[model samples]
Target: MTMDRKGLSPDQLKEMYRQLLYPRLIEEKMLILLRQGKISKWFSGIGQEAIAVGATLALDPDEWIMPLHRNLGVFTARNMPLSRLFMQWQGMQEGYSMGRERSFHFGSPEHHICGMISHLGPQLAVADGAALAYRLNETSRVVLAFSGEGGTSEGDFHEALNVAAVWDLPVIFLVENNGYALSTPVQEQFRCISIADKARGYGMEGITIDGNDLLTVYDTIKGVRDYCIRNQKPYLVECTTFRMRGHEEASGTKYVPDALFDLWAQKDPIAQYEQQLLKEQLLTEDEIASIRQTLKQQIEAELEAADSGSTLIIDTAAELDAVYAAPAITALPTVTDEMPATEKRFVEAIRDGLYQSLERDAQLVIMGQDIAEYGGAFKVTEGLVAVFGKERIRNTPICESAILGAALGLNLEGKKAIVEMQFADFVSVGFNQIVNNLAKIHYRWGQAANVVIRMPTGAGVGAGPFHSQSNEAWFVHTPGLKVVYPSTAVDAKGLLMAAIEDPNPVLFFEHKALYRSISEPVPDEPYVVEIGKARRVQEGTDIAIITYGMGVVWAEDYAAAHPEISVELLDLRSLQPLDHAAIRASVKRTGKVLVLHEDTLTGGIGAEIAAWISEHCFSMLDAPVLRCASLDTPIPFNTELEKNFLAKQRLEQSVEELLGY
Candidate 1:
């Protein structure tokens, strides 16, 4: 008689059993520690161990795997140092994130594992990006993204699935349907019969299987993995299992029915696999006891070794370097007020900056909505597709979150991506991927997201509330992000060059009002202006206008019109890692200073400048630092109302009030 082997030998089956046993024993050890007050918390993957072990083993070891909160078996299966994992749980200095992030909230690039963020769905999009890189490189490596059933409800999950299907990316989405999402059951999460059924909507092939059977997970994923690599297509596999433990140890499982527990108890993956090995004569009862004893002893020893490591404490000075991959841009030598002979608009200079970068770097790809043959909504990239083709200047779906996540994915393989937001307001939809994932990746995992997001921002041309609002303050408050806003065409080109060359994520804000309105003699040759440098538009002794973007326009015009005022205007090219020396020098030169910005008066960037001046430059100030800003209201669609709502309306008056004081 012949039996189905599923291409596995007895030794391989025994090895699979050993691999699957690690997470269960490790989880039991953690539970003992939790009760003893040695560990704070843990998300138990007790009953669903088969999906993690089997799915990880199905793919090649070098391929990428983005694990979910409950997939602790992936870590053990990857053979991560048990000592380091214990240290990570204890917030030791030798842990993966250097104690910056706790628990499974960190990634290990050496192991080709992308870490999980607390947010459920955005990481799925990030996994799609890694697959996109493999597709671009023409490598057969596939990426596995693990998600719980509840995570599929998020828009990001749908967007990621849609992109992978449309692009035919090499990815295997593993949905571990454990019947409960926190306290909410799978029934309340979606109307579909199974998570795999949702794949039909995205035009992808899918399967649903018995997750409690280790053989089913191994067999299904192994076959699906080959299909993904061979055809470069996405496949969804939903493994139906039960989470025997609560969401965490803190959240009790009282809501689950007693009968449900009794039903699932008979289907426990480790017990079923062990019994199968006995029935197949692969292992004896003595060998099973010996394996369990050996694993428990090993866990205790590793835990004790990790306990001996040094504890991690908050070191703000040491942590400062990890926040940004590159050093802050320094001030350059002052230049004369003479213009070069050549000329270009701010948009033209921006186009030149992008074109020059693309022309030089073969690995760079530009992704955005309507940015391909259309050259973007503003035609900033017009005629480029005719030169570089659509693959490099790619048009993307209207999914900001996915695009941002993909940009980070593209960065994983040393390739760079430049993302263009159609309007700055659209960034709200992509905010989590930017602030939570991209910005934090460098600090948490030492992974640099070498991407530039061109924010077509600010209100002036009556683009209304959705299209025209100054939202720079939102990023200014976020750590690990660089903010750039240039006023002149030359500065736009130079600053954009610096942003692209920087090793981390940069939010390049280009005011829509100044794009076509401002023109200057910009040099054809490529050059990089320092990001944190503040350029002096004019020098005077009486007062100084500290501003950026459109504020520079209003201040420069006001100063030019009133020559007798002896005004000095400063244009801050960068916001984060701001040029404090320039600000102090200007404050020291002039007795009075006024902070100006186009954003609303409350909670604007100007407020920070004013507060800093008051704290650091109070002795030099003849009067208090004053702020001139727009009223706290949305930018109006009406032309006249917009003018009334802008800071330019009260700029001259605010300057006069400061001068009089």
Candidate 2:
């Protein structure tokens, strides 16, 4: 047989045909297992195998491929063992995800392939971030990120594409436009003529192609990959195809039009490729039959092996350990009385911490809005850009989700990214990525999200609801994330340094009100204030006031004015890994507890601390565990109203009541 015009030899073409057949056969067996009650569910890519195989085959082995749920052929093309695939489907402990996650929600770091999360668009930015890392590391590798046409509507899609184009990252976004996004048809999903056309808006080339044609897909992807590698730029390719089956096994094809299904069935990619190979005299009918029989037997054997493997029961201890792996505390350069300390503002201290971390680690990258030229929204990263250069300190568009998602990708590529959300309130825009993707990544796939999100939080200076919000509780509630809110300049620098070094995701909330308002003597040398440990601000015996961030100042001020109440002030810097020992010790000594925070009264970190005190140190408490926080309402814009809303008088009154009790 003659070699194909797309540069594939007869053997390579046959191998491509085999790759297409494997996923189809595997899905068919998965459906059978589903019917037999051996599997819980299945999402089959029956008609889109050619697109997956072609796109992956065109990339170099070192280049990364982030696949969606329907792109099983991509895994098969990458030479993933069929038995391991079955093990994943069978939920065995030996699977890639160790049976922790179901379906295609697992990735192989060894293969440089990221598994898909339920939310589709986040991976787009992650792929772009990985590409950025490759460029910085001066590697020839590129990245291919896949998503459905439906995911194009998500904010992450636009953010990722825009960032990739602006930075000229080597990322190829392959969109599988399979006509429908689950139940919604293409016509209803978007008004645009083609999903690929959107790439033009992002200053990147966009191409639409027939995804069902194996050779066409292979040729198009090869050309696109070459362009991305050569120019260090991004390209978007939309592979127009159809989903021949339901979204999942139990979903049924009832929502699909029978006529449309019949129309696409005639264009079955596998059958078409087989006929093409036969027409070219590359394979006989007997050879095709032999290939099918061999694949079927191999799949069945894998299934048998997986079914005989030991089932994985949930390990509670392991689950807890995986949620948050605490970083070890390393000894810092000792401070001597002869060494003078510098008086720096809270923001300056944070900048110093970042400067030190960047100086120490070449892999550290800072990303946020206005972070490069403007030096961040609050100027916390000011002047450092000139010191570190634009490559290390990047200015991202106002895209919180993509910024965080891309940071995760950078972390995956061995680069630590510190993402700054201009305001704490704006973080809600990227809440899904944080709660679902970042927080759950380690627990589900064992991927470390070593990224720090710097949130300027608080309710002062009359910045109103949007700008002034202490939203630390949201992250503290998340299992896999570490939360830190430092009140003083010294702790701010120390904790920020520690957060940068930690191997887990840390939300570093810098009080917006304290940026220029507070100043203290900070160590010039690098130091790491251990995460999850509380600092004893002042030691006293009458009352133990436990707080963090701006609340610590309030507690100190109240104690100074009264002079009668002997308060043991403790700053609980880290919220998630709460210093229970400190809390119990203080409560045991004083027999009085007051949990104060600037966040709203209900469902605040204060409430969690109060509850812990009630549960653990109930007998030691002299008065009912007291709590003081902002009113459970949006922070008012007016200064007077805000003061009334988050009144210090109310806290003083509560303290008086507690002392009386």
- Report model 1's TM-score to 2 decimal places: 0.97
Least accurate 10 contiguous residues by lDDT in model 1? 330-339
Q: Candidate 1: lDDT of 498? A: 79
Clashes of each: 0, 0
Model 1 C-alpha lDDT per residue in residues 1-661, reported as the tens digit of each score: 3335588999999999999998999998889989999899999999999999999998888888999878888999999989999888777779998988889988988888898899978888887888888988899888999999989989989999998998788889999888888989888999988899999999999999999989889999999989999999999999999988999999999989989889999999999988888888899999999999999889889887887887557788879888989653533222233434378999999999899888877888899999988889899989888899887888898999999998888887778889999998999999999999988999898898888999999888987889988999999998899999999998998888778888888999999989899898887766778888999988888899999999999998999899999897889889986999999989999979999999999999989998998899899999988899998999999999999999999999999999997
Instruction: List runs of model 1 lying over 4 Å from the truth.
Output: 1-3, 327-341
lDDT accuracy of residue 645 in candidate 2: 79
What does candidate 1 score in Cα RMSD to the true structure? 2.1
Collision pairs in model 1: none
Q: For residues 236-295, what per-residue lDDT tens digits would candidate 2 score against the true structure?
A: 999988988888878888888899988988888898889899999888999989999999
